[model samples]
Target chain A: MLIKYSVKTALTGLITNKSRSILTILGIVIAIAAIVLIVSIGQGAKDLILQQIQGLGSKTIVVIPGREPEGPSDFVNVFLDSLKEKDYKLLKNKNNVPGAEDIMPLVISSVKLSYFDETYQATILGGGDDEINNLMARIFDIFPDRGSFFTPQDVSSRASVIVIGDNVREELFGESINPLGEKIKINGRNFRVIGILPSKGQVSFFNFDDMVLAPYTTAQQYILGRKYFDRIIVVAKSEKVIARTVSDIEITLRSSHGITDPDKDDFFVETQADLVERVGFITNILTLFLVTIAAISLLVGGIGIMNIMLVSVTERTKEIGLRKAVGATNKDILRQFLLESVLLTAIGGIVGIALGVALSFVVSLILTYSLGLNWEFTFPLSAAALGLGVSAAVGLVFGIYPARQAAKKTPIDALRYE
Target chain B: MHLIEVKDLEKTYYIDSVQTPALRGVSFKIKEGEFVAIVGPSGSGKSTLLHVLGFLDRHTAGEYHFDGKTINDYSEEEIARVRNKEMGFIFQTFNLLPRTTVLENVKLPLLYSGVKESLWEKKARQVIDSVGLSHRLHHESSQLSGGEIQRVAIARALVNNPRIIFADEPTGNLDSKSGKVIMELIQKLNNDGHTVILITHETYTAKHAERLIRLSDGAIKEDAPVDHRLVAADHFTK
Candidate 1:
């Protein structure tokens, strides 16, 4: 019976001071909304990173030369031709890396391709002839739309033949013209187009639809002449042995490069699983940092609640006296005020969650429309639950001082108060 | 046995290092179902004595007994329990909750009385009707007149069926007409077998009670029975 009375009284108290209650609850609302938004956006970024890594195919391992680029300045390390041809040969030997099924080396450069009078700037990719065909078609899912890729004999002979992407074909030869078996000029030299590639849109923020592919030996020997590979993609025999293959490639490359110190190795090897784990770790830290900053606001919100409750206690002194005179115990008065503050924060928390969900939808829409990013909308259930739990804890923690002050008022003094 | 017994009751007030005695060595007792008045000028400690009697304040020195049991050693919790079950208070200001309806104000005590939920509103309505404010059951205390507010307070004091009602200047804030009506109501309650201890400075209000105890300088000056004017006038017509 007392509990029922207390609840009714608490509700009446809130209604009696509507504007003050709303302002106090608004503090909690902003704090909880910030928490939900941070966690949701963090989860979205993690998903995007994982999706990018997955697009590389789980069975593939990547090798980069010149010490793994750890920071923005280290990106220049891609220009260092530390991984020589001998290192690639040693890694491809079955006895050295038994877990490897196939290896494909890649070299990329920007060049102008011309078909008769029209010309367009395009990224030129150089890879082994048949290896490029099988790797692009099977692993990357890129296949020629109208014609077949060149043969291994073409790569051995350093043939001046090229396969053009969908956008490159359209740009140089126009959509009406079939570019297969047409002759294109590369570095002012005549080169024949052997195939046309279907568009693969964009993967990992790079557009594969605006590039041309040629035999690695042909590009290395003739156009923008270079003898070193930029990056290598290795297909593991199976998922179970991917880790073993990573270590084996590291040892074989280090030995071929004549490196004795592990730390001084010129190349870095990474599997798809390792990339996924690294992305997840970075995103988790970002989430934690954002949440910690938001929690400071929650602390201030709790303090605001306490300030309002203290004013309420002072305003209701006469009522407290009356209640005490009519047989209400100190415990009853304490419980009444505590219930009111908890109700305030709990309701604030629920409203914050709804607002956060709506905000996340707007964020995802902006990402998709303006930036053309495939952003996913997520409402993590644990975040909502945590928001509610934290709000309740804040209410209890901040409400106690004011509530105890109310309970401590003696009936005679309270009744005498103006 | 006396319904109330007091032996040299004393209460002292301390402000900073100063000791001010509000009540000094007052003694009195009353039988069951009696209507008694404690009258005095302001600062004569009549209100202080009433508060101590109602268990709203503690006595600095005293031995008090109610219904043959000593209450001098009762803890604050024990006193609160006894007040809930046995004591009711009617304040001079008609201290009904300003935001609540008349019925809700009257039912406040029953919320602590352990009454069944189904009977709370019923009992509250019955007492409100007896006080003749049944028509204003749903009206907030702020919306009520002074007379109606005091009547609601009386109904609240009666809702728990307390053994004794401590009314500290119950009509001090009302007009003379309303004050007379409140005095008559208290007389009727006493006649209906309810113990009432009224505290006031007005002699005319005390005249309605069967007995009077006058205080001066924190001590009782006179303790005697008076010819109750209302009861006497009714007797003469009969």
Candidate 2:
């Protein structure tokens, strides 16, 4: 019965005072829209970052040497301090682990190159033939381009043959040069380009499409004199071998380095899947922060609704009195006013949802076409329900007080009200 | 038994620091089926007395009986229930709900009484038609003329089939002809065995009542009954 009267009264009020009711509801609409839009954008950013992290490939792992702040450094540091070329001999032959079909150490350094009077600068990476083999499947997954990789003999003999990325060729050769077999000078040493690599996009601060690769022996023996490898890349045989393979690799590498403490181990082991989960975690934190701020703004909107409803009650005091005189009870008065509030909130929620979806859609489209990213638009039902439900709850909580006050008004005083 | 009886009723009004007395030791009685008019000048407390008699306002101190039950012990809800069940009220301004249609205004009491939904429209229409407002039953209060609006208020008052129809200056806003028409309508209702209690300042209006009670300075000044046999039925013929 309250709903009926409320629907009728609200409908009449909406019709009678079109501009005022719309203006009042506009505040709630904007607040809800801002809430949904901010959360959606935050969620979109999180999802995008997570997707990029996953695109690094989940089967791969990275190891970083633990930093020494309070305790003594690992044997790798001592080896670097003593300057011995024999440490490489200890690590070279230990290949038969449970999961590792191959493991290769890399030489990474920045090199400035001049090609046919054109200078292009890039990071130069060097590793064994097995290093190239490990990346073959990953490159095919993302790029699937044309070129043969390095071989065991080419790396073992310390061949001067080099592989250049597509962007480096474009930047240095420019317009008329396909320098697949051209010799490029790095630190005054000449190396012939063997194969032009396909574009592999970019990760973090480095452009994968602008790097140069050579035999690890060539880099250590000719370009840089340091014997210790800069990094190591590995590939497990299959998904089933991952867990056993990782432990076997860790144990083998630990004994080879003469380290017993896992915390004080020189190298760190991380997988691409771990990186993806970290990205997801960070996105959730960011979304949580953004939603907290939006909720505060929604609180202000609720206050606005409460204030307006109070004013409406005061302005309609005489009407209330008249109704009471005609035999309307307190409950009837409360129901009518409360219904108006719910209607206002529900309508605002719908408009806000539309705005949020539209804005997020536009951003996703721009990201996909203009920025050329694999930006995915993820819409979860939980997020939508949270947005719609909060708006309605705000309505009920803020609206009930004024409704109660309106209901409690005495018929005598209300009738006499001006 | 008297339809309404009040004795030594006192009412006080406090605006701020000063206490203004409106009804002091007022006493009056209206028998069943009596058409009584309580008259006074502006500020004479006649309206206040009528309000107390209608249960719309409570006296600060009073001994009042409706039919036979003492009203002092009733709670606000109980009083309102009694008002809904026994008394019908009409104000000078025709206090019909402004935003509602004439039909809805008349049906207001039935809604309050929790009457069956099916009988609401039937009873509302019956009373509205009986008040000769059948043509304007659906018109909004704001859209009705002064006389039409008073008729709507009367229809509302009769809709619940109350024991007494209370009118406080019911025709004060209407023209003399319309006021006379309204008074005659009240007389017809009173003759049909419903008690009618009117509070008015117009002497001409009071002449239409069978009994007159004059109030002065918050108390009853006179209680008298005038014989309508000596009064000419037609004004032009008299």
Candidate 3:
């Protein structure tokens, strides 16, 4: 039979039983929709993370006081105090690390802040000296919406001064009240809020809206009572010199800690490029896992198609016999049925792709408006194509047996079939 | 050479490995353009003989030749081609595809024929018109009366312009008046120089044909020409 007529016949057959056809393809539709939704959302998340990492500046490198964590269990190493004052001082020297532009020793801890009866738990970020403090501000793109950052005099004299995030300011003082120069009690010591930060939801891994910033000297001596630092942030003079600056910082830290072997180094360095790659790998793996799970539905969907096709063949036995008597060959019968199944699944795939895209877009909108994240709606074209291709393949694989069963019917027996 | 010739044809049905014979050594020869009826009571194997003659089923032990070629002489594809080009079938149930228009039902055979797509509708319309169903060309089969449905089935069988047409109790399911009309239509097809093979249990209906082959108990009891054939046109108009 001509392919055109075969398609017409198949379409007529499917259309004659519209409800059954629709119900038959439901599995395929849901499966493809899930795959598309997962891949699109995964791509969106990866893009958001990469964009945030890029916001940290390509020339900036972070040296954490731990060996590179390989898994969740190794995360405890992050709290080690390997990056101390001496190591920070060594990295700051121009002769020791020539490519370094600015280096800041970082101390991070959760602290409770209270102003009168209002109390808020806020993350504390401490940086050394005025220049280091300025570099921290530039790296995080954070500046006070009101008042100013504490000066170098405050750092040297270990003044009890603090910079508060938007949320922290809202919590300690009501929105109507001016919070600058108001003293907030922290760990039994009174610290004056010298700056109020603008609300920035999340940058990299930190939510700047819920943090408190102060000089490392006062935080370490009065608040934390620790002599060691949690991390050291380094800025390369140019993007091209980031690699050299990272090596220089590593060499200076390793020598300052009296480490001889490179494998025995107590700290690990991370550049923005490394963080982007790691994020991509993690997201890709997550997307692949979800896609695999979605494929099980496709398998079930294919079986559903096969089951429906078989039932259709049996129910239309007389029709098949009539077609045979009218001179349709076995191959023609097979082609007609196979085309019916493939067309069914391909339609499901298209509808699924549309549904998945619409759903993900709605979800991204929710994340952006309600949750206040910079979430983007992404249409994963590759996933759409793959979904379409896989659905068709599912049709072909599952449709063959039923089509063969249809083709194997002898005209006399089929015509006599009740 | 005869258009269809069979000798010592045998067909056995194996149900759960038990042998049950449907046709026992049936033999017959039909010439071109002859109107022959294989008439028998129920379970007389006349239907089985018609099935083997029409190439709708294979005879297990037989020499059955159609157009001077044995069934094995043609490949599976060639057999389908021969069936498409040379034979047409009318079932007892009319078998017009439900929910399909009269024109589309007649056009079904042409879809499987070697005819061009551009000429399918034209050929189908001509045959449907010949059956006097031109007024109901767009009507669905389910909407047609029993007599009209049979006419549509006849149109479908004639659409491919086959050399031989087989009617398996063409008027079996109709009232007497409609039956007379259908019998008249089949007789008219025979008069138009198409070879006709009719299967029927009613001797009164079998008399419409010029020759009759009586079958009983899986064998042919008699093969003879009719002395007083019933002319269907004399009894029915339109």
Candidate 4:
């Protein structure tokens, strides 16, 4: 028989029991939909994080005060205070690191700030004088919406002037009150708020809206009461020189800390590109895991298809006999049943792709509008293609036994079947 | 050569290693363009004889030749092709596919034949018109009467222009009046030079054909020409 008639016959067979066909394909629909949703959302998250990491500028590199962690147990080494003021001063010298544009040492700690009657717990970020502070602002792309950052004189005098984030201002001083020049108590010491940052939610793993910035000298002398630095931020002169600058900073830190062996180095440097690669790897792994979980449902769906096809073959025994008597070969019968199943799963795949995309778009909308994250709606075309292929494969894998059973029937026996 | 020749054809049914014979040492020959009826009561093995002749089942021991080729001479695929191109069937139950249009049902044989798709509708319509059912082309089988359903089956059998048609009690499911109409249609087809094989238990129905082979106890008891064969054109006014 020609393939066209076989397809038409298969279509007629499916259409005769429209409700049963729909119910049989539901498992395939749900499985494909779940796979598409997971892959799309995972792509969206990866894009958002990569975009934020890139926003930190390609020339910017972070020098964390710990060795590169090789395992879970080594994670504790990240919190060790290995970077100090002398290492910072050595990295500042042009003779020591020629490609370094600016170096800023950061000391971060969570602290409570108080006004007359209000108290708000916020992250405290302490950094160097004006030039280094400006570099930090340039990297974060954030500046004061009200007052200005502290000057060089504040670092030299250890003056207790501070820059408060937008959330701190809202908590201690309501919208009606100007928080600039207000004396906020930190660690039982009075500090004048010189700047109020604009409300920026999350950027490069930090929520700038819930932070307070001050000169590093004041934070170390009075608030934190520690002499070691937490992190050192380095800005390379250009993207082309970032690799050379990373090695330069590594060598400088090692020399200053008297570390000759490369493996014994106490500091680790990460460029923007490295962060993007790591984030992409993690998201891909997570998406693959979820897709694997969704494939289980597809297996179940294939079994459902097999079950329904067996029932259909048995129910149409008389029809099969009639067709054979009219000269349809066993191969023709097999092709007809196989085509019916493949058509069923292909339709399910199409509906699933549409449903998954719509659901992902709705979720992205909620994430963007309600939660204020930069979430983009991504359509995973490769995943859609993979879904379609897998669904068809499922049909073939599960449909063979029933189709063979149908083709194996003798015309006389089938006609005599009740 | 005879169109069909059978010698010592035997069929045995094995149920759990217990052998019960269905066709025992049957011999017959049918020429081209001849209308023959095989008559027998229930359990007389006439149905089994029809099944073996129609290639719907295999005989255990036989020398059966159809169109100059033995049953074993053709492969499975070639047998299906021969059936599609040279033979047609009409069941006692009028096995028209349910929920399908009359036109589609009539076109069923042509689907498996070597006929071109562009000519299927034209051939189907011509046969349906021969059975006087052109007006009900698009009606589904469920909407058809028993007689009309049998006519559609007849149309399907003729659609591929086969050399022989096997009608297994074609009018068995219809009323006497409808049965007369179907018999008239089958007589007209045989008169038009298509070979017809009719299976029936009634002697009156057997007399409609030119020749009769009476079967009893899995073997042929009589083979003779009908003296007073019914001429459907003279009996029924159109």
lDDT of each: 0.85, 0.73, 0.89, 0.89
Candidate 1 residue pairs in clash (backbone atoms < 3 Å): none
TM-score of 3: 0.91
Give each prediction's DockQ, rounded to 2 decimals. Answer: 0.63, 0.32, 0.73, 0.75
The candidate with the higher DockQ, 2 or 4, is 4
Report the TM-score of chain B alone for all candidates. 0.94, 0.93, 0.97, 0.97
The top-ranked prediction according to TM-score is: 4
Write down the RMSD of all candidates, one decimal each: 3.6, 5.3, 3.0, 2.5
What RMSD value applies to candidate 3? 3.0
Q: Which candidate would rank higher by DockQ, 1 or 4?
A: 4
Candidate 3 residue spans exceeding 4 A from truth: A76-79, A93-101, A128-133, A152-159, A188-190, A237-245, A291-294, B230-238
- Report lDDT (Cα) of residue A338, candidate 4: 91
Worst 10 residues of 3 chain A by lDDT: A70-79
**Ten-residue segment with the worst summed lDDT in candidate 1 chain A?**
A129-138
User: Candidate 4's residue-wise lDDT over A1-418, tens digit each?
Assistant: 7888888898888989999999999999999999999999999999999988887777888988887888536666753788888988898999888998878888999999999889999999888664444655665788898889887778878889998888899999998988888899988999999988998888887788899988888999999999988888888899899989989888888888888999988888999888888889989999999999999999999999999999999999999888888999999889989988998888888888888888999999999999889898878898899989999888888888999999999999988888
What does fnat come to for each candidate?
0.67, 0.20, 0.80, 0.78
Candidate 4 second chain TM: 0.97
Model 3 C-alpha lDDT per residue in residues B25-72, reported as the tens digit of each score: 988889999999999899999888888888789989989999998988
lDDT of 3 by residue, A247-293 (tens): 88888887788888987778999998888988899899999999999
Superposed model 2: Cα runs more than 4 Å off: A67-113, A123-136, A152-166, A191-207, A212-265, A379-384, B1-7, B27-35, B53-55, B64-87, B104-127, B158-164, B187-195, B208-211, B224-226, B229-238
On residues A69-144, what C-alpha lDDT tens digit does candidate 1 reach at each position?
A: 7763656564369866777788888999999987877788999988888999998888773444445445556778
Runs with alpha carbons beyond 4 Å of true place in candidate 1: A1-4, A68-80, A93-95, A110-122, A128-133, A144-154, A163-186, A190-201, A254-261, B1-3, B66-72, B232-238
Interface RMSD computed for candidate 1 is what? 1.4
Q: Give the Cα error of residue A282 in candidate 1, in Å.
A: 1.9
